[model samples]
Target: MSGASVLYDAPGPKTKARNRLYSIVGAVAVVALIAFVIERLGAKGQFKPEMWNIFNYADVRNNLRDGVLTTLEVFAVAAVLSLALGVLLAVARLSDHKPVRWLATGFVELFRAIPLLITIYVLWVILLANRDALGLSGNGPQFWALVVGLTAYNGSVQAEVLRAGIVAVPRGQAEAAYALGMRKTQVMTTVLIPQAVRAMLPTIISQLVVTLKDTSLGYIITFEELLYTARQMSTNIIVNGSDTYVPVIIVTGVIYVAMCLALSGLATWIERRGRRTKTGVAPATAAPAGDPATAADTGKDPAATP
Candidate 1:
């Protein structure tokens, strides 16, 4: 009883034992259910292997590679534009001018409130109508419409993320910048924005992932993106007179997941590099003004002396 009391206070022992038992039971049940489902599905031919065989075809491979490239192109363009728009909108919303602030506020709210699918569809229709003036040809209209719609929606989300990041920073920092006679735009661009960017990098990266996934929505506008290529391939390649939809879908999904995972890996590397430095930029402290002694003296004590 004394040994048990020292290791796991009173009721803790029973609770711990119960939790372990429950975990083991849960794991076993999940494995059993999964095994049963897989066996049943396999027996019924629902898990056919040939559906995934389309990847071996040169045509399918070429089309999917093209689709992958197009998807990356659209995502890159939209992500950059969205980040730029978000920064501008965030600054505008924080503006002293009533009109500028109001306009920015309305724009962010309106787009954020609307579903991205509807926004893309509407833009597609609008672009199709004025295609000649916009120099639209080939996949240009669909691309631009997808880009613009994604920009608006993701921009709104990123504006809020930026605003939140800015607000999270110590108020003293902004006040200090202002006290130094920096103009509003200078303070925001040179100081606040950079710091906010570092602090909110994860959120920013997550929004980029959203933008990447949103590129699939381009299919609705007839854009020949990844999903469109998959659908086309499935339609053209019927295995034994049956649609090869499942195989193409699996391949396309794997492509998207791979791209996203790569982006995530890059973000992780950046984050690690940032942690090795200060503010994801230059070292916070510059080289000493002169001698090491003078530099140390000039720098305020990190801990308050009693």
Candidate 2:
């Protein structure tokens, strides 16, 4: 017999033994599955030295580097645009006016319900048709289409996440701001939105990761982004009478994973900093000439500062 938590009862010795047995069995099964996969891959010559030799070439490395650069470019642009769009949509949805709220709701629902790939394809067609008028050249149309499409979908999701965070904030804070004669916009921008952003940052970063992966869809629009470049390389490059697709795919997948891990690590670092550092203005030092430094020490009274 052992201590039990509030939510669940503690397992007895027999139950713990059973659980350990199950875990061992599960681990063995997973190991066996991995071994089987490696054996199959070995039979297919996927790990052949010649397949990996292509990576040693300068052109191959440059092609992969270009792909990674393009992917990052799209992700950066889309992340900024999506966050901006989310802010606008969230504000609009929270608007006092019925028309504005309804319009924002419709826009969000429409984009959220539409498949992202379809959105990208449709936008690509429209952009391609008006390329000259839009001054789009080379991969510009595909780039914008993918970027805008990612913005639309991710923005809608981020809007919902932010809205939830905003609503989660204590209602009294907004009322206090209102009591202080602050306008709705000022209250929202200064008090509400900041709290909302801080609360929903993890969700926002997760969505940004999704946006990063979504860049791969640019291949459908003929955007020469990382995945597209890798695909082309795999199709063209031959080693020992076999297309070097496995190596290309493995390398491309690793790059994507690395990029995502880096983004997650960055978000984690930011979250940690946000925890360690205080928000808003730093505490004022002792009052000049001592008009009661008590208020200055506590940071409670603005009039106490010189």
RMSD of each: 5.6, 5.7
In lDDT terms, how accurate is model 1? 0.84
What is the C-alpha lDDT profile of model 1 across 146-258, one tens digit per residue?
Answer: 99999999999999999888888777677878988999888888889998999889779988988999999998888999999889878988775688876677678888898
Cα lDDT tens digits for candidate 2, 1-306: 444455565879998999899999999999999999888987999888888889999999999999999999999999999999999999999999999999999999999999999999999999999999999998889999999999999999999989988999878778878988999999999989998998788778988989998999998888999999999999999887888888899999999999999888878887877665433222334324343433343466444322
Alpha carbon lDDT of residue 214, candidate 2?
91
**How does each model score on TM-score?**
0.82, 0.83
Give the range where candidate 1 is weakest over 10 consecutive residues by summed lDDT: 279-288
Q: Could you tell me the TM-score of candidate 1?
A: 0.82
Candidate 2 differs from the real structure by a C-alpha RMSD in angstroms, to one decimal, of 5.7
